[model samples]
Target chain A: MGEFDLIARYFTRPPRPGGPTLLGVGDDCALVQPSPGHALAISSDMLVEGRHFLSTVAPDRLGHKALAVNLSDLAACGATPLAFTLALALPRADPQWLEPFSRGLLALADAHGCELIGGDTTQGPLNLCITVFGEVPLQQGRSLALLRSGARVGDDLYVSGHLGDARLALEVFRGQLSVPAAVFDAARARMETPTPRVALGQALRGVATAAADISDGLVGDLGHILRRSGVGACIEAEAALSVIAARDALDAEQALGFVLAGGDDYELVFTAPPDARAAVQAASAHSQTPVTRIGRIEADAGWRLVDAQGRALQRQDQAFDHFK
Target chain B: MGEFDLIARYFTRPPRPGGPTLLGVGDDCALVQPSPGHALAISSDMLVEGRHFLSTVAPDRLGHKALAVNLSDLAACGATPLAFTLALALPRADPQWLEPFSRGLLALADAHGCELIGGDTTQGPLNLCITVFGEVPLQQGRSLALLRSGARVGDDLYVSGHLGDARLALEVFRGQLSVPAAVFDAARARMETPTPRVALGQALRGVATAAADISDGLVGDLGHILRRSGVGACIEAEAALSVIAARDALDAEQALGFVLAGGDDYELVFTAPPDARAAVQAASAHSQTPVTRIGRIEADAGWRLVDAQGRALQRQDQAFDHFK
Candidate 1:
């Protein structure tokens, strides 16, 4: 089939009912209007076959993960999902793959009320890139889109939902470790389809001081927030250990390693003042995504690992970098 | 070098002065505030090596063409330039290539008053995907962004700037044809740096009834407008022959072929009612872009080509298709 036919049969859909998309696919460009008194939050992510996903992955899961990663950026900014465009390069147009892939992609989009507005597809090496657009409210003329620069000294550092499971799954995939079948399956699922935590991000909108999604391990992703905010932080091992969701089959050291430096965790790492602790907890409960206090923002310039008693310690975490 | 360091060294520039981007590169997501009463027009295009351009082309030209093609889409919609996101994958992090590549990309962005708000870079095969955002005005309850669905029977078809030079250059690249030194150089330049008619697109805004960009050759791209508008068209061969900007190097048949079916023109093919011919000419003059009336919208459902004597003729023009 031609490129146009491939898109029409598989990807084209009417814009979401009453959604921000004024016009969707089939045009030279898609036209969307952000709500009045709001700004558009945009993010772009590119995923290559071997770099971001294994060749063995199911197409549906790959589709879900592709959009999920971009959504995580929107989640970090506490923006409500609006729509996304996908630019895909494939070796060929295989119907068996396209069927489930679109199903998985649109399914998550529907769950988040995000519309698949427009995109391009071509025959080439397998690569997927998604650029997501979201809306953030304006507060007294200031956009409420959270940035990593808003953290202040002595603010309580928090992380939403769980982390480490996805990284642990990678270890198993690499044959560095093995786990029980159930644990392995669950960890693989986490790796393949990590939740985006969009609701939690929105709930913490005005309540949290600063935020970032944990994609390249807790310490590394947290480093982004610290560098942008020009502050340091301290992570307590005990608190961080509790943030690992798939720890039933792993020992304490392995779990700590995964929690500290393992990448692919799509949870939010945020900061809020001590006085807003109650408010933070309220947002957590409201969004139904658990929040953990694992670190504290500091006036110093570099992060540190601490024990349960708050004594500084050495680390085993290594953040993921595409070009190292 | 790591990914973050690479981005920091080469790509982390601030948003344009007084531009719409409230927050730019450093954040998890870029935040841009569109003017009130305007909608954002977004387009995404992917370029894979060996498919979109030759490997021998300079990095700077490739960079310019990447953004230029996307801008062509915005022009088709009559959208004003805005901030864009770039998602790139490279085989390696070579500064030698990146330095010149970024220079070409940003130079065009500055010229158009468009900002490179944010993007992602990863290690993979060479690929560039750009998601561009533009703004279109609203009139009453309707958006002024032109659509392919708006073409009506009896509308006069128009095209902005020139066409077919890019296709002629491709023929030379494939060793299917040869030309004089000056002709080859001019055609190659047109192929590499085809201008995006942004000003002309915006000027034609309310004047043009329907529009589309010529990427997959004139016939193929115009076919899109015809299908979307549920109307047919008739191309006058004589008027089309005038669109061959690089025709000095070729015979009449070859020039007509390139003009009729050559892809990568990056020009606007649009329609205006007969009564609005003066307005169309005014827009062309105002934007300093020449336009040619080559065809007319028809009541039927398929297109036809007629000779200068107004008689139907056989053809040799064939549109470019990736799969075919």
Candidate 2:
């Protein structure tokens, strides 16, 4: 089939009634009715072969990761996932590849209530781009969009879930790391299926003032919040001791290095008002996701890592850089 | 500099407040409040290296063409241009490349009063996708969207501007054609700089029903209108004789062939009801654009060409298709 015919067969659609999708795909333009009493949040990400993913990666995983990354951005913003548009560039129309790719994309989109709206498919090298839109109640003012600039001095810093599995998954794929079968499976799952903390984000709406997803490592992402909010941070070296203790092979020092510098955790790192510690605890309870108080916001301009004795620890920032 | 820093220095901006900008850039989402009583028109296009352009094409031209093609779609929909978002993927952080590219995109965006809104920049192989939004009047029972499904049997078929120069320019670039400096200049200009018929699109809002831009040759693009409208067309070959007369060293047959099958013209091909012919004429006069009466729609399912003698003329459909 031709490119246009394939698009019509697989992607042409309209929004279902009684859902987040006011208008689905299939037209020259999709009519979107923003949810009443909510502001829209939008983000776009593109993945290219040899850049974002290896050609050997499964089509299903590629599709899942494409949507997952965008969803993670929504998690950072505390927005309800709404819809997305996909633009695909392929070397040729391979139905075998397209079928599983579509299945994987639809599966995640269905689970998240993110309707696959409009898209364009054409012949080119493999490049996948997805633009996603979400909604947040506007009545709460800046509560919906958790800005990177809201962290105040003396505020507590927190991170949800573990880190470094994604980067380590890449190492496994590249044959640089060998592990037990169970550990390998866990790492692969983490790499292929990133669980975006959307629930945690929504719960943190009114509780956490500054938030960002750890796509570029906790240190780099938190640095964004610090720079934007004009504040510093003091991260406790022993805050994630449980994650370090759970490690069977890696040491606390090495795991701490990854927690701070490893990328692609798809977890929320946020700062809450000092007086709202109880609310922050309550918010994490709502998500049923573990919230680790890793650090505190400070008045200085430099980020510091301190031991229990209050001695500073020298650390290197190894955030993911696409061009690097 | 890093890729993130490069974007911050160049593309990270909201449009300055003025003109048609309801909301500019710089946030998680760009807010756009169109003029009251106007329905928004939106379209998107993605251009990939080695597929949409040669590697040697100027970066500025690539930026201009990316936005221009989407603008042409809005123009076909009878919308006034408003704002655009660019999703750019690059192989590396090259400052020299980005400066000119942003300048070109901003120049066109400024000239058309279309603001540059929020977008993403990342490292990948060269892939650039642009999504543009425009606005048109909203009136109950009054059609403003120039749909592809409104053509009727006995309705007139018309096209704005001349054709074939763009395809000829490609041939010239490939060293397959040699001509005088003047003809070469005309053809090259048609390829390098396309003028989207925005004025004509606005004027045709009330005058025409079915409309589309000619990107994939006259016959192939018209076929889209025919398929959507459920009608056929009978073209008067003599009607396009003027385009042939304007060319040198080419017979009528060659010129007609080029006009029918050559792509990238970016002109509007539309149909109007017999009763709206006067309005179409008035629109043509107002815009100072050439609107030719080319054919009439038919109840049959296929388009046919008839010469001055009323005899069928055989022409091959040779529209450009990235994947055939």
lDDT value for model 2: 0.77
Runs of candidate 2 exceeding 4 Å displacement: A18-27, A36-38, A139-143, A240-246, B18-40, B136-143, B241-246, B285-288
Q: How many backbone clashes are present in model 2?
A: 2
Using TM-score as the measure, which candidate wins?
1
Residue A255, candidate 2: C-alpha displacement in angstroms: 1.7
Worst 10 residues of 2 chain A by lDDT: A240-249
Q: Which residue window of length 10 is worst by lDDT in model 1 chain B?
A: B315-324
Most accurate candidate by lDDT: 1
Interface RMSD of 1: 0.9
Cα lDDT of model 2 by residue, A1-324, tens digit: 787777877666667776654334544544444555565566777777876677887888888888998888888888888888888888998888887888888889888888887767778878888877777776633235776778898799998887777666677788976767777778677777788888888899888988988877888888888888999999888885444222565667767776787677788889997788888888889888778898799999868889998899898766677767
Regions of candidate 1 where Cα sits further than 4 Å from its true position: B316-318
TM-score of chain A of 2: 0.93
Clashing pairs in 2: A15-A24, B14-B25
Give one digit per residue, the lDDT tens place, for model 1 in A45-78: 9999888889999999998999999999999999
DockQ of 1: 0.85
